[model samples]
Target: MWGGSGSGVDYDVMEVYHLPTGAWDQKPTTGTPPPGTWVYSSVAIGKDIYYFGGRGAGDSGYQYQNSLHCLNVDSFKWRELSPSSDYDPMKKGFCGIISVHFDGEHYLVIIGGLGSSSTPKQPNAQYNNSFGDLRCNEIHYYRISSDQWISPVVTGDRPPPINDFTLTPVTNNTAVMFGGETDNGVSNKLYMISFTETSVDILEVPNPGGSVQWPEGRWSHSSVLITTCSGPHLLVVGGDYAYDVWLLDINKRKWKELINLPNNVTRRYWHSLSVWSVTPTTNWIIEFGGLTEYTDTAVIELRYTSDIDWSTSVIPLDQYQDQLRRWILSDWENLGLSKEVQLLRGHLQDRKREFFEEQLQREIKEKEQIQQDRDKEQQQLLQEKATLSQQLDDATTLLEQAEKDKSSLELEYNEKLNAKVAEILEEKTQVEEKKQIITEDYEKLKLKVAHMEEQYLKEKHIIIDDNQNLKSDISEKDKVIAKLTSQVEEQSQNEKQIITDLKEKDLHIAKLVKERQERVLKQPIKETSSIGLQFNYLEEQLQTKNSKQDTPFSRFLILIYLLFISFVLSTNYNSKQFIGKI
Candidate 1:
């Protein structure tokens, strides 16, 4: 229904069939578009029809095109989509690329296709040879919002390498992939793939029971999904040069053969089928051109539904008037015209007439001016020509002498030129010899550089190993230093406890001496003297014990301080060395 060729030539114009008038209307298009092509992929989403990847106009063989184009169905205008940065322009073009829309019609999933390494002159030649290598298994999707192609990571079982398959949407997120022809042979296996924003899931469906007969392996078939009173089912029409119709109940996953197709129906492949939902419960499939049992043609629906009950049509006379009004408004905006266009046009006409009159008058004046100038120039030229003639006579005499001198000069120049050429040749040879020597030296230098690079890599690895060993040693040392620091802190705490105990003992002793003095004052004089001597002796003993404890503690402090200083100095020295190496 979109684009096809006839009689070994492709058409560029778009035409629509008017059911009311029962005639074809060749719609005018805007913007440049490629020539007509078959086996290209086209999908309708809203008011835009997206076209991608088709063969060029060649009857025997064709060149592939890897371009994306879109047509506004409402405006009947064609515009090429700029290839996104993610798309490779140099990739070979292909046909029979399967695509499906998901994510609320924001993405188009492009699946397997047939491509070649180089453009061949004949399609038969491509299939006969190099078909295996030409098949594509990569999956890419076009994001409508951002207008970019994304190659998604697909998981689960992958479909076989095949092209020219039918992909019919079963639900919002899923599509039923039917038979496709491959290099191996035609495929009868059915598979389903679920699409998401980031990935795709593919699973092959097992055939139903033996009671239900299945369609044979085929490709280039047409399948359309239509909803009936019971449920939605898939209708698969002729494929691989056979006129057979099959109905598939998607929910039951079973196939039922459709009966009573017209007897004169011509089997076709590589054709297109489109559905027209006329009412809430009725739909019709419109089939288009492909290779029939005989040849290819720009054919429309060969078979028609006789009893298509169309209670109302989507297109009407009022709709056409609305479209006309919109088109007029759009054309006015595009041409930068306004209500003042008519007024401006009239003003231009007046200005043009005035300009012609002015031009005529100016030309008349110019003619008079030219005549006077010509007369003046003729008189001057006559006078100058007479003077030039006399000069010519004088120059003729010298000219003879000049000619004689020219011959002698030319001979001398030739000799000089030959000598110069010889000198140049000798210089060229010497320079070439010098260049050879320099090249030899450069080669030697290159070898030396390579050797040096190898040596440097070995040295670098050695240095890395040494650095790792140093780090391990440093780690171990750090652990030891932490243990020693903790021990020092514990010892300092023990010393503080000892000093506190000593102070308490001194307070107790002083209290006991005071009590003895009070008791002696109350007793006899002899008793007082004895008590005093005992107290003095006890004081001296206590002082000796204090000095003994202080001496040992002070020496221990000095030793600990020296050890701490040595540990800090060693740690600093090692840290500096490590940092320098790094």
Candidate 2:
């Protein structure tokens, strides 16, 4: 039996009543630490109920607890173990404490939880914030034989500091942890930690799309692992002051949401959840009292049965009704001493039927309203369709006109390009004729120079042979020399004339290049102007067609508007006429 006081206490107490003969007996307190000591971790070893690590008698808000106490179930006697100074260095709250018999000896294991200190602040002097202080991820072990604490060196990427995560022993050395809140302010991720003699390996379960997103990150949720016919499965229920329940397949490492409890059920968190295999084929998971969001006075019991395939089993609505029917039938068969109760039940059932009918009518009315809304949407769609059809026709006409303009512009551009090509050919012919004339003049100058050199050589030989008349010969030689000098002067003049001609030709070529550049620059602008004119002309024609089409469309719209108004008026008139006839 469980009862709570109206005082705002952090912990609520529960009395375990053993009713073998249908009589109640109050069990004595195990350790009288104080009133309101919130029990966190408990395990039954033999006849003694061992409790570990719970907050007591202060509003420090669920701080780190170190007390270890045991209650003998047979005699109801309490024994308190001395607190140890040697812990895992990190003080933690909501740590996973479990009792496992390894090699015929009992050992208590503690895992990750909220640490004692806040996170360290960053180095910026102006922004030393306190939000970083949080939890630590560490594992510690306590040996029952030596009554001593042993810190085992477990290796792996330690999980982020989090609390309220479930740690269920899947096997002797394996434990699976699922959804919990982290201190770094992130969603909870599913993690599994396996232990060997040398190290611990933490593996993350990958969520390939679908509804496998971890149960919305929450804390203080209860989880229990049980061996079913299909194998071991983890069942989690009522988390972070909520009413949601979920199941996790340990072998598959996937979570499946469970059906929500009925309205009569209460939401709870940080509750005592335990699984008991009632039969080989059936398991009963029970939830005891916990603090609800509204008040701590609330007490609720939720029992879920686990079959072979608990993940796929869905409780049918008909099954709920059938169970109610069975209960009613059983009560009626046992109502021989109370006949009036059966009549009351019949009256209640009739009232329930009437309420259900009223609810059904309300649902029908809502559906009819939804249908009317859909009809209004259909009418709007029809109007939009007519408008779109008109726009499509206008667009098609514009496209045709644009095509015609484009073809005409292309024809004009080709004609202009052909004319320009002809002009370029005429200029090229003129340049070629000038080059031929210059080459002929150079050949004639070469022939004249060669003839003058031959004549000078002959005069020099004649003067060399006449030795008798030396002065006369000298005069003749001077004459020959003068003739040769004049010839050389003429040849130099011809060569200078040829050089000047070549320079003039180079100038002419440069002028032609400049003119060609100017023409090339102007051609693109001229083509663009012609194309622009064509585009403008097409646009005007398209506008005219669009305007003509718009007149008909506007008339159609006006007709539709007038028809709608007439329909509305007629509908109202008919409605009034019918009312009058009635």
Candidate 3:
């Protein structure tokens, strides 16, 4: 019995049929029970049915229930087990729990599941960020006798935290875990987890590519282990967005997807799948419950035979159909195996034998075909090997010739490189010497200009003072008019001599400036060089002064200064450009 919609208020009751009395009884627990929830893990061990974690009724955090309860099938009584103090029930739910009997003791094994947190049931909106956390990967074992939860030491390539996976026990010590949802996305990887007395080891099964097309990635699928005459294999059923069935061959470690099944079988998730029969004659995988486009209450069956083949048969009855519904409500004895059905079974057995014979013959033919193909491939390989050997010898001869050519070219390149380096070094030495000479001349010119500026300022001050004295001595100036005239003439002669000397000095400066300009013009401007930067600064200064107020004398001085600077700049620019050509 389980709870469904309407806030989980409606609990669906199960009908149990008594085999001997041929009577049906509606069974529902009367005592206090676990909360109504979804996605819970349950397993039946002997007469007790155990239930674990799932989504409970409420909102957000209150929605995940962590209760563990067991119902007695014989007495219809519910009992809750109290784990040790170290074990917390709230965090114990929502894991893939299974009961396995080993060494005469039953132990409940729990695999990965959703942790104690709240998340959106369906994260449809793009902006919804409600993914919680995944539970631990360590396998948790609960001892039924001791009532203790023990986490065994697990080693090997531990799988990432995942949930909604199907873990079916293949044997007492081995179990196979199929696809599950992870933080990254849905996974289709399969692993074989082996349990021992002290430790657990998990090994990933490789899906080597071959003729068989593997199943696509999915979660919330159903898988159950079944033993066949060939070997043990897992029968996987429908999952989210899937209606196809696949079989995982344990011995071969490969997948073979089932096709051509009845059309009524559709994709399902949160469905129950189990091994319905383990008889040698016919084995069956039964699927029930879960949603497919909407709520589904259909029971489906898959029949397997010793010939290692699968077929689906419709039971012709469902949970809702009243007519022929007694087929589901009663045991096999109540609706005894009719003679017609028995005859059909016998016919199936005959067909099964015929299938095995045909299959055997097919295998022999396939083997012979494979052998012939292999021999043909071997002959082709030998011929190719001989052809490759001849080609390799030719390549070796060509390689030697290429090596000789490379050595000659390398020698020629080295010689050219050495000559270029020597030429560059000689040029560098000449440039350094020229730089020293230019720097010395520049220093001399700078000192001379400073001296001239100082002398000009002193002479201007003295002239102004002399004019003021003449104005104050006007009366004396008239009485000594004759003496003043002679003094003026002498002063005029001295002024003329000074002017002549100044002109000669200016001419000397102009000559030196012209020579430097000629040298500068021989080279191109080196934009990043120190001399280039100085030239730019001087040009700016000349421009600024020319733009400001100026007298006739100052203007003439500016003109000469600008001419000298411009000539020098032109020379440097030409020199640098010429050097680049070299």
Candidate 4:
């Protein structure tokens, strides 16, 4: 079971169930930031939990927030830190927070955050124009002694402009940041940034290429610097859009990819990772949910072997005490306090009996519950087995019956097929016998037809030759008759020609008699005028008649008609519409 502080979206403090037998009753400090807020840095020093440089609240579309808050583990109280008197303002967003304890003093270092700078753009800019630019690479130390934040000058070159990078305290003075998205939006570089009591140094760690790179270039990843059997190693677990487990050997400067997490473990980012060393051999790292691009409240656990690497061993409390008692008694004897050591040993024995009795009763109750659950599961398995056996028996019987039915059907089908085959064979034999007899009869009929055809052809040839001789004789007689008719027609034509010559001579004689009669009549009429006068009068009358009928206008009329004819010819040539010419 899990518990959290705050109501609505601002669920900040997360409590996990750690006790084995009792219900979880722990609560986190109230008024912490909500669960979905991006907690960029966190470090636990002693019993204090300090978180800084997270962004939430306001209307800046993810306000670049810079506030430091601390949780007292015993009191569960929330404390917010303000800007130091010397510093300009409480730098938010871009700062890196890491906890370090050196020389018996704990300090929370805030380095490189977005702070007050020149306004980025003009007032009338179309884009969002609030928050100033990133500040210099000054590291501010929160000294727990003075309860004040101090801006310390960082030595060497500063890290490139970046936000949301993970910082893990490898030693009391050194911290490693790996694979965080820069302001330019590129990830995948390991940076070893260390701070001594005097100065800070940043070194770029070259990547050793392999199937996968170390510090797997991601933003909002959770990492914890832990001491294991192999010495101080940084265990980098989940991150934004990553599911691989990576372990960085800080001492050896090497890296190893761990096995994949179980299905129940979430591969997420921007979550809280905390390491609590319960014993010298066992250290448990608890991860509470943060923004997984959206709000997430998934909690995950990872167990690491402690530096001492103590294996499981049981030591009876009585035996442990007896050894301590003997050692203390020896020291007392040298110090002359033997009587007091014996009294202390007697008191421990009396309390041990009562404690053992209580432990025995609790163990008995737990064993009984375990036995009951085992019995119930065994009964269920038996019932399932019985039911499955019965079903299998029924299936077997049905399958046997189906097989018998199939066999009977197959025999009947075969018998029917055989009877059909026998009937077809008998019909085939009768048809073959009939076909042989018909073939012999066809051959005899063919010979008889051939003999009749030969006899008919010989008679047809004799008749054709006799017809040819008769046609030749008839044609010769017709030609002789045609010659005799032509000779008779020629004699008739000669007689007719003689008759036509006599008729022509008679016509000539008649014409001569008519001409003589005309001449006699003309001689009688000429008595009234002289012959010359009659000739002149006739010539004048002819000339006057020609002039009156044909004037000069006739020539003009002829010319106009000729011109109209020419115009008609040209118009006919130009008039292409009738022919549809182009």
Candidate 5:
């Protein structure tokens, strides 16, 4: 259920009742939602539920809206749709809305409603009660695909200007409308409404044959269309000051009263009924809240079955876990650690995986440090090798210089020169061996460094992927936890309307009692004829004034005074004395 007024809830709340779990969960919404409304016309087409024209308390005060809003159940987001053209639908509440498909295009058709127009073109709308309205025969439609409002040709005797009626669609081209409050009062009659490509026909269904008992006139009653083994049947429930269940067979055009209900479905009005299960053998329908007798009476169901060996149990889509999660995502915030010890065992394995990841990250850092140290050692070894080569070049140049001066000092130091050259040649061989060993060590260090770098890069990539996965897990959990964190967009209905309605009911009851007493006293007078006539005339004047201006206990003093005067005149059998006292 979407937006409604109730005790404690003020704003529009998207509440989901899980049948399997038997829990009511409020789904948080996004975007601007329509103000909390009652008597609004809403029709679900595919996944989107469209809410149109309802009376609500806005920033500007109590207003009857002509605004259109859409809610996508999947996303729990609301969108206020702006009319494409300057001309929009009428500002109304208690209107009838149904989706009609023509040429594969969907349109929202709004029938008769009770409200006023900005221009008030119609001097009097429907029974002259709802003045400044031009909406009796007016049929407004919205092109769902194009976001545009268009007018269609409407025909037939549209059910006399009505509101708060129940419209149940039985076929693609038709629907059945039940009781509604009209300028003529509550209607118990049914109107078979048919739709064409560009026009609608609303004609009354002839009274059921055989003088069967008719469902009493009512408005704001609940009805749903269900298919039984025999065919489709329309079952209607309680209405204002009513507690009766009535059923209609479509093919036969007959009415059947379902009496002796297992549970007492007390008198209620403005309630709602939705078909819970539809099968050839049996059908179950669920009834919801409305103005009831008292707090104790609530939540009734109507079940009708054929039971001809054709029965199957079907699970609703909401019973599935994944989709239900989306509907109740707000439930994750409050978690009770009722089984702390038991839950710790379940998370032990996960903690081990977390430890392994940490160890891998540390190993990668150590490998990186080793790589830096190896690079420095390799550079030092290369510098030492260059120094060794330079020393060998100096030794070779000294030997060549000695060869050039050999003739001059041939015999003088022959033994000494030979010994020194042999020593220098041995030294060169040792230096070459050292250089070869140094080159081999540098090659080993280079291969080790390359291996460490490759391992580090591979480990680093794995950590990056792990980090991304963790981020994703956090994000998904955040969405689940964000359900009721904020409801700044939520708004509620004002209490003034409820107060006014209650006062109206109280005042009507008072009027009924007053008129009943008057009828009893308005009889032919015997001896006190003149006083009785004067009393009746005075009473009529009071009634006229009260009708024009109904005030709370405004006539208390007047009623007491009138009663005293009537008593005096009735007691005094002599007319002359009564006139003198007056």
Candidate 6:
């Protein structure tokens, strides 16, 4: 067991299971080890094992590796092989690859895997951003000798894009593929791939024919080509979550169930399987680490040990010295067979004939049963054909009668159709006339609406202009009123000035009268009359001026008071009457 992952860890290390010692030892790798070897394909060619694409460790920050690395078993060294052509199969995981030889050159033929949209995809498959994550069905091969990557013009019935499948090579040019995940889901269908000098082909294979149960369709399963004296059988071990085992007799194309390890082996997927042949007859089909239901330490001696996580073991288990290994050795019981049939034979060359004879009888019986089924199918088909022929004959007669009826109907239809056409034409003419009249009416309405809108606009403008003119007239009347009020205020101020002058004049007249009287007393009584006359003239002049100033000023004051009746009284008033009231 080399590189695979399950439970919780990806096994980038190697472990050696010694048949003689019946123990497992963690084989310390010397050179550059794979960064992330999760679900990668590592095929042994000669002494070197070539590891190819698979998922990287999420915690370690690795990406799906597209680089090819080789680990030499003898040197325990790793060397990375760089391909010349940098093309499709962009960093991918869960890919299937097998080493094949063509014309003396060793090549690695690869198939489907899961990748992102950045990776190259088969042009035939439809993809959308909704499921930008893609799976590959394109044929990619690396020429090992030349260190070159090549994509051959693939022809034939190619399988749909898939991931996590097994490709157990059956021949130099052909490899049998079992279950994998496709767009449709996990599949159990089988396919055969044929590799040539310049191209690859795929052909879908029918599942093994038998009354016995077939293995459940699953992905990330393990399958190995277990060759026997009877024939070559594909030993398919635990897959996904099932611990059920099955064998496919390649020659017979039949499936046979092995004893299930539901109680013993932890059901797993993403695991590894290898065969340890101790002798020509003694063999061990060793299964290694994978996903299981529990944090199971490797089972041994039927002891339940959970002290360590053995999921990382290539052949999973955990025990002393951090040794991750759990070797489940059940010899013939594991094989679900006896020592003779299990190939753990002891000088029993005679049993080979017995096994072969038993196989021969089974084959003969299967063939006879298949032949009977074929005969039955043929009989059904013949019966169906005869029934179909009778139906066709009846249909032909009905068709002939229908054709006669069709001719008569066509003739009658033509007469009716002509009359209908004439009536339609007359109706069409009437409709046209009506349409024309309606169109004319519509035009008239449109014009009338436009004219009404125009008149409304004109009236609106006229009203606005007249309202503005009225406002202007009101402004002019207000200006006139202000001018008149200003004039009345000036007149009132003039009246106040004239009244002040009259008071001063009266004081001066009184002073003159007093002086004249003093002079008369000094000059005797004879000049008294003359002085009095003068004083009287002075009084009359003063009286006449006072009368002119006092003519109806009170009435004018009343008019001013009436005009200011609605206004608040101002403090500037000097009139005696107004002041006294205040």
Candidate 1 residue lDDT tens string, 228-296: 555667778778845677767677677766654542233777676776543334454555566774432
Clashing pairs in 4: 10-34, 11-34, 66-92, 94-113, 95-113
Residue-level lDDT of model 4, residues 442-494, one tens digit each, is 88888878988898898889889888988998899889889988988997897
TM-score to native of every candidate shown: 0.46, 0.45, 0.50, 0.44, 0.50, 0.48
Greater lDDT among 1 and 3 belongs to 3
**lDDT over C-alpha atoms for residue 27 of model 2:** 53
lDDT (Cα) of model 5: 0.68
Candidate 6 structure quality by residue, lDDT tens digits, 328-427: 2233344465554434443333544675687699789999999999999999999999999999999999999999999999999999999999999999
The lDDT leader among the candidates is: 5
Off by over 4 Å in 1: 8-10, 19-22, 57-61, 83-105, 118-133, 263-266, 293-582
- Please write out the lDDT profile of model 2 over residues 408-498, one tens digit for every residue: 9999999999999999999999999998998998899888889888988888788776654797888999999999999999999987985
Q: Clashes in each model (backbone N, CA, C under 3 Å)?
A: 0, 4, 17, 5, 3, 3
Error of 3 at 303 (Å): 3.2
Q: How much is 422 displaced in model 2, in angstroms? A: 99
lDDT, candidate 4, at 233: 73
Model 5 lDDT, residue 145, Cα:
83
Candidate lDDT scores, in order, read: 0.64, 0.59, 0.66, 0.58, 0.68, 0.66
Give the clashing pairs for model 5.
10-492, 11-491, 11-492
Q: Which residue runs does candidate 6 get wrong by more than 4 Å?
A: 1-13, 57-62, 83-86, 122-132, 207-213, 279-282, 294-582
Per-residue CA lDDT of candidate 5, range 1-582, in tens?
A: 877657676354587775433346788888887753777888888899998877778678766777888999999889988521225666777788888877788888887777655523222224234665444545677888888876666666667778878888787678888888777788888888888767777788767546776788888888888785587778888887567888888777778777755333546677766664422334545566777744332333334434222222322334433322322222222234336534553464465467568768967997998999899989988998899899889989988888877865786588788899999999999999999999999999999999999999999999999999999999998886675343322322334554675578567546744764565467534535444565677678667767765665546645665665656444434556656655
Model 4 scores a TM of: 0.44
